[model samples]
Target: MVKMGTFFGMSLGAFVFWQSMDKVHVWIALHQDEKKEREEREMEVRRVREELMQQAQQRDSVA
Candidate 1:
């Protein structure tokens, strides 16, 4: 009877651990995707700023 209870307890613990690990993996994936999007937006802003600076320089040279 003790052996049967031990087996049942181990099985339950293993199932709970598996579920928690699966959630952690999903959270990591979502975090990575958000990081990628943020980097892309920053790059776009830098590009636009450079273009504006170039245009202003050209206007000043003409004046």
Candidate 2:
């Protein structure tokens, strides 16, 4: 009976540990995705700014 109880306790503990690890894994993945999205947005903004600057320069030269 003691052995059976011990086994059940260990099983429950292992299950809890696995659940915690899964939560951590999901959290990290979400942050990574957010970071990538943010970086892409920044790159797009930079590209647009550069294009606008070039257009302004061309207009000035023409004038």
TM-scores vs. true structure, each candidate: 0.92, 0.92
For all candidates in order, the CA lDDT equals 1.00, 1.00
Off by over 4 Å in 2: none
Question: Model 2 residue 62 lDDT?
Answer: 100
Q: Candidate 2 has what TM-score?
A: 0.92
Candidate 2, residues 28-61: lDDT per residue as tens digits? Answer: 9999999999999999999999999999999999
Kindly list the per-residue Cα lDDT of model 1 for residues 15-63, writing each as its tens digit.
9999999999999999999999999999999999999999999999999
Error of 2 at 20 (Å): 0.7
What is the number of backbone collisions in each predicted candidate, taken in the order shown? 0, 0
